[model samples]
Target: MPKGKKKTESRGAGLEEYLEGTVFLDLWRDKMFLGQEFLTWLYLTSEKNNHFFELPGGDGVEAFFENRLTLSHGRGNNRRSVAITTTEEPRDPDWDEAYTAIGNNKRVIKGTLRVKAENREWRLTLPHDTLSPQGVKLSAVKDPAETDDLGKAGKFLDKIALTAELVSIVDELFSLFLSRRLSETWLTEDVPRLKEYLSSRT
Candidate 1:
């Protein structure tokens, strides 16, 4: 087998395990509703501020939902993918439409994300199943002209490292969400507030 093919297959296998295994599906279980709450709350939170939030030991970043969202009701009802942006018209998609759907017991299953950290930016589509980032478009952190071959290799490695750090930031955000979700805070605070946020939407 070619070295590149082997590496590709190995990565594919790992992603498969991550997606289909008990770990991710356990979170996806209908009753838990962890994914839905996390996303809905995130959308609400970002709207109230400049979307500025910090990960532990990291400078703050501005992050927001990037149009695409998937919402589902248990079964029999067809799943929906929505583009929640102002520019996509004729469709005229807005929160009120989504709010109505989810109110009928639908839940958000996926969303694309945009994050700006300092001068660097990243765009990723996230499936709630594993919180693994997909279609990750990352900004270059180093100027190519400043580097020789070995230095270029090191800069490439640095980009990979930065990519991992950026994606892991989502996982940390998930952890923060999960902590709040599992607590009574979700019911006592977030749920009521989520209802208000939904109602207030256009």
Candidate 2:
């Protein structure tokens, strides 16, 4: 057998064996609601303060729900989900329907967010169950094809830096949410304000 093919098969077999263990999957299932709460908190918080967030590390970013939003209620056989989408650019999408759905006890299940940090922007689809960023569109950078080899490497590094920055931003933001969510004031302060925001919207 070819060396490369043998290595690939070994890696695949290892991965399959690893996935056969259910410990992490069980933990994820148990704690999946945290992701849902984070997304819900993001929407509530963004509705105030013009969708801008100041990270715990003192970095400022603006994030807005755009393009699509999904909300859900119940689980298992009783689960129901709805998605809201917009195609227009520049003009903000109206979220009255989503607000109403929330008022009816639905939680945010997924959303497309446009986030701006410094002068650059990124768009991603975030799902509540996993908190993974999907369909990510990063800000435009220098094209490698238009540059010399050295310049191409520099541009490639620039892209890598942007990706790392985005991951940091997401981690920090989620950490902030977890802090607030797990705090003593969440029920007394945040929940009341969140309720008020929904009440006003509906």
Candidate 3:
């Protein structure tokens, strides 16, 4: 949130690759899988696929994956590919072709994500590598004049709050995904179904 700041200091490794010699690594591994799997399914379910991720109370969010996709070699690595297509590749002719990228031993790391909730729409790029969102275009403020905090600080505060809310929506979406993704039904039922659907996409 610090805009136009320069980092003039260096620090140690913020995190270990595997969190070796600890019990947290188990959590880390599951988290890594959850993130990647969620991203993958989100892309697969986008744009009139009838895969609306249900919100907590009611209704659902319409998810759309943008044309630009970043694929990586597995989970942790510097290697990544950014494919910029002209059309809505996930929902159009190139949809089936997009899966071919993942089949080639690469995983979808992140992409331009479009999520619509109520009358507001959020567009941002979410990185699975660190769970950090970038280039966020958050929803419009419902009422900016009613703020107790004033001026730039107020605006920033509102932005941060809205951003956290948006991220919470994403977290809810991930939970919805995990319900099916972590189930034994996923392997026995959903996997075959998804494969059949993908095979039919062309």
What is the RMSD of candidate 2?
8.6
lDDT of 2 at 116: 85
- Model 3 scores worst on lDDT over the 10 consecutive residues at 1-10
Better of 1 and 2 by lDDT: 2
C-alpha local distance difference test of each model: 0.65, 0.78, 0.66
lDDT of 1 by residue, 65-126 (tens): 76666666664456545544444533333556666766766677777778776667888887
Give candidate 2's TM-score: 0.80
lDDT of candidate 2 at residue 70, scale 0 to 100: 93
Stretches of model 3 off by over 4 angstroms after superposition: 1-31, 74-82, 87-96, 141-150
Worst 10-residue stretch by lDDT in candidate 1? 1-10
Q: Which stretches of candidate 2 lie over 4 Å from their true place?
A: 1-22, 91-94, 140-155
The best candidate in terms of TM-score? 2
What is the C-alpha lDDT profile of model 2 across 56-115, one tens digit per residue?
A: 877788887886889888877898988977777853534788888888888888998888
- Model 1 / residue 23 / CA error / Å: 9.4
lDDT, residue 164, model 3? 74
Query: Which residue pairs show collisions in model 3?
Result: none
